[model samples]
Target: MTATDLPAKPYRNTAFDASINNPSAYASTLDDSFAAIDWQASWLCHLNQLGYISKSISQLRGLKNDPAQTEKLEHTPDIIAKVLNTALQKHADALQQSLPQTKPALNNQAQTLKFVSQNELPEGEAYERFIGTTGNIPTRDNLHDLFNGSIWLTFPKTKALLNYYHMLEIKEQGIGASRGRVRDTITVFDENGAILVTAESSIGKALVDFDWQESLVAPRDKWDEPKQLNKQAQAAVYIFGHALLEKLLHPRKALCAHSIVINVTQDFFTLSLSERINHLDQKVADYMDALLSEPDVSPRKLSPLPILGVPHYWAENVQPSFYEDSQVFRSGRRSQS
Candidate 1:
């Protein structure tokens, strides 16, 4: 496959299909124009009648809908949030409660919690601990917090793990002015992380080396991989940070991802969308575990991805000249190319 032939979306939920009975909308594909699409309506319309979402997303289309509210989307932070759906905004508050506590590393059991005001957090109480022990994620009525809650639903394990680490750091350092390296790493990722998966290491290396032309344009077919099962695609980006997703709502070239790249196995290409999400979540969690284990591993290290540069993610990326804008696809830390 060539660049033009690259798959539009790596995981499933590419667009409305025969399931929705609307071939025209299914054909437009919400992927074609990010800025032109309607977040409230057009986005929700493309889902597979009833579906789910994932953090790095075989599913952030992970979103399912109520037939009555097909056009309406509401935000509720409850684990039982199955009714309200538009763009993967469901089961946020309650998803955290359903977690199995994945490992002993975490001190608290994931259980039911109700949404409260952000102000409810005690002044000296660390935010992570408050959520860990009380099981309540004090939510504010805002997009940032709303996105944060929704991500919890998409990838509960990864989100819980992040919180555990944050709580651990806070306990050791007592929430000082300096959050230290671990918290900083978690914060950076939690705020702007995206999981970049490619079958070839060279593709990931090209991205980290700031070789935008090759990573983002060349070998584009690698990202799209030959489709199998009518849904499979090779490399993909599953947005982990709510902030990053919020930024994508407006869609700009300069926007970037603090990406962690994983060179996946061929089996990964064959798994269903939900399976892919679980795999990526575990991989990212393992990466975080490594960051905690080896001090010299550079917790601060993450590849910078000009997110829009992903093939077919942004309509403007179709032109070879799109990568020419040095402002977005800079060479490296050095200003000179």
Candidate 2:
């Protein structure tokens, strides 16, 4: 019999058709009759929708075109779910494999904590502990994960140094307080991007003295117009931390020693995924010389600066009520102390 004339599979069964109404029931009906490649593609699409998998539309289409396993099968929701679970497991395995073999020692404690894989970090006590002590762990296959993985690979020492300080804070202050402090010092919001830093002793106080409320929170008629908005000072404050951190790694002209901000324009998103990764890789390499000169892996004595979400990327920023209930833009009377 020709491949096209092969007997109908479970995917084409009438029971499968009726099971579509109840996804849980449908998944139980799935057998090995369904083509593996078709199932994988369907499952990936579902993952993309649920934010578990991050891939460009073009890449996803390419996966669907796998010629080796071509069998027509309707993509039922249940089938998609099964495929997604499989894909997630595979991705988790890959991530775990990519992690460094030597886990860092924590809190003068000789016992080392296993590096939690991305899939296992969404919930549970382990996730909470990881976030509380180590800062944020990026979700697998997402842009944040990609960037974070790059950061870890490029600046293993600096990344570990940051995590050590984060753990120390958690040990001293409770997780709640420690997390708040981390939000202030680092940009956990990968979508908008973040700049983190420790200001030089001389300029630290001055940097925090500005009236951020009046400058960043006030309502404006043309919020989208960059020129119309008076946010340079706020921008300076936001980027200062990142600039300062970079400067510490590589000290250059004294005049240029202070922090500077790098804006991620809309153009940045236009680049291909590999290009985006390369761009950031090159940016870090530019400062590798300075980062290498650091005397040791010990944590630097630095204060947590204010955290600023990327304004340009925030959809709410264009609305009139953007700053109305914003915790970040709220008065700093309590924080200033």
Which digits, one per residue and each the tens of the lDDT, describe model 2 over residues 170-289?
Answer: 555665624543423332321122222111222333223433334334422212222222322223222212233322222222211122223344444445432433354345333322
Off by over 4 Å in 1: 1-37, 40-120, 225-232, 297-299, 334-337
Q: What is the C-alpha lDDT of each candidate?
A: 0.59, 0.32
lDDT: which candidate is best?
1
For model 2, give the RMSD to the true fold. Answer: 16.5
Best by TM-score: 1
Q: What is the per-residue lDDT of model 1 for residues 1-337, given as tens digits with 9 covering 90 to 100?
A: 8763342221122222222233222111122222332343211211221243222122212232224333343332222122113223233222322223323234554443334567779997877888788656766645566567666655566777888887777777876788888888888889898878777777777777888877778776666521232234557666788788777778788998888888787778777655676677788788777776567544447778888888757668779899999998887862222
RMSD of each: 11.8, 16.5
